[model samples]
Target: MPIWGWPMTEILFFFEVVLAGLLAGTMYSLVALGFVLIYKASATFNFAQGAMVFFAVLSFVGFMELGLPFVLAFLVTILLMIAVGYATERLVIEPLTGQSEDTMLMATIGLAFVLQGLAQAVWGVEVRRLDLGIPDFPIPWLADNLGIFVSALDVTAGVVAGVLIIVLSLLFRFTKMGLGLRAVADDPGAAASIGIPLKNIMLLVWSTAGIVALVTGMMWGARAGVQFALVDLALKALPVLIIGGFSSIPGAIVGGLIIGVVEKTLEVYVGPYFGGGIEGWAPYVLAILFLLWRPEGLFGEKIIRRV
Candidate 1:
């Protein structure tokens, strides 16, 4: 098939695929950030991050349905996330104080299962319309008298994502609280000895991760409507973690972009020949390929252990 023969709409569809891949990467950054934060603080990889994102989004949507204004609803949801974070540390993490990294990781997996059940129980196993005041109608563009359109939703998603990355970078770079967080991540034992309040910093990271998850959920919910469907997006983030390295912020964002673009492009261009499952597994395939070449990931820190 000649590329020049395609309809204008088809070309616009290609643009949308690229935008979605980039946006998916941004979303993956947020999810992978949650994993990295928890991992950095306690050396435990939290497998429940996807569930956490879905759960936070559900909370935001559910709270808005109770008639609260968006600002108020968002604040309440953040506070709720803080409480959840504290509980996660005190209850789930605290009891396993002296466990190995593998043990803690397994515990987080259990937490993931528990969170999945909690989402079903709280949301009643049904999909809900979760609009958060974002309108998504697109305007049309013309080329050769053919229409190519860009969606208001896609524009908003991208802008929201860019703004979020900038804001997070600022938060982690300029604030006193942010400095405390870095100290904690770099060396908790040293941080504790120096009055950095190590446990408090861990709680803050979890709460911050929760807040990021809330935004992710709202953005995603706007596109697909909130439901248990969020778990699918969360699952897509795992391969992102592998490619980005377990502890790198830049890694998360870049890995996500790579996965998103490759997966979307393949699904559009090559999926028909492979029974149409490209969208579901292509990211994993890409991650495995990345892993084989650089086991530490592109941005992962290289730690030297002495015997």
Candidate 2:
């Protein structure tokens, strides 16, 4: 019962694959949340989110290169990302107010290019290492006792993503700003009528998305190195959005984990039989299948229009 010349059918190996998939899925959900947050607030897709990940990582790495400590670089990068969010809201979103969603989305596409150019201009297109103080080695006890191959980096990333999800869940459930965001998502005009401050809410959402992008960049960059390719990883979020729904946070999380598990399992167990390289298409196929079953996604609400 050897698969791909390896004993992957073993129960321990199955658990190992599941753990790896979960970690990968957490990273995907981290990126996918950027889309969910923005779409929920403004009803416009932020195509620039992936670009923002690159910019944040590049900026953070640049700061680190300037002799700043990791904590200082990270905090400064967050402030700068917030500033970028504010600028994007004022310069791109504000002027495009009242425009169609298509127009606003186009603006975001342009913003993506602008951000990419800025990163290249400032960071000189060099792929730089991003060390977030996480060790790259695996835990010896887990590896030896459980026969599970887990990277410490993956564990660190999973813990960070879990903490982030908890913090955001708390913020959304217990904060006035979160209330405003929910109100805006329900109905912007109604939210505005109730003094929810639509503009401010949008700004806050964008800032929050920017922060998510920063964290995504740090974790992914620490794993893959900071470079333009990081933006490609961001594209994986699109399938996540499709599978999870455009506006559901929990959907993003669930969809990400599903995608991660499906793709990893396919690559590890099935790809060998099919000549390999199934990781890229497997998630999309899984998403298409899910859509056929539930068009609105696992946690997404179905809309019923009045005829």
Considering summed lDDT, which 10 consecutive residues are worst modelled in model 2? Answer: 3-12
Counting clashing residue pairs in each candidate, in order, gives 0, 0
Give me the runs in candidate 2 sitting further than 4 Å from their true place. 1-9, 305-307
lDDT of each: 0.78, 0.87
lDDT by residue (tens digit), candidate 2, 1-307: 6766667558667887888899899899999989988988888899999999999989999999999998999899999988999999999998997788899899999999999999999889978988777887778988788678888988888888888888887888799999888888888878889888888888888888989999999999999999999888888888888888888888888888888888898899899998999897888788788778888887877855676
Winning model by TM-score:
2
Residue pairs clashing in model 1 are none
147-180, model 1: which lDDT tens digit per residue?
4444566667667766776776687789887798
RMSD of 1: 3.0
Model 1's number of clashes is 0
| TM-scores for every candidate against the unseen true structure | 0.88, 0.93
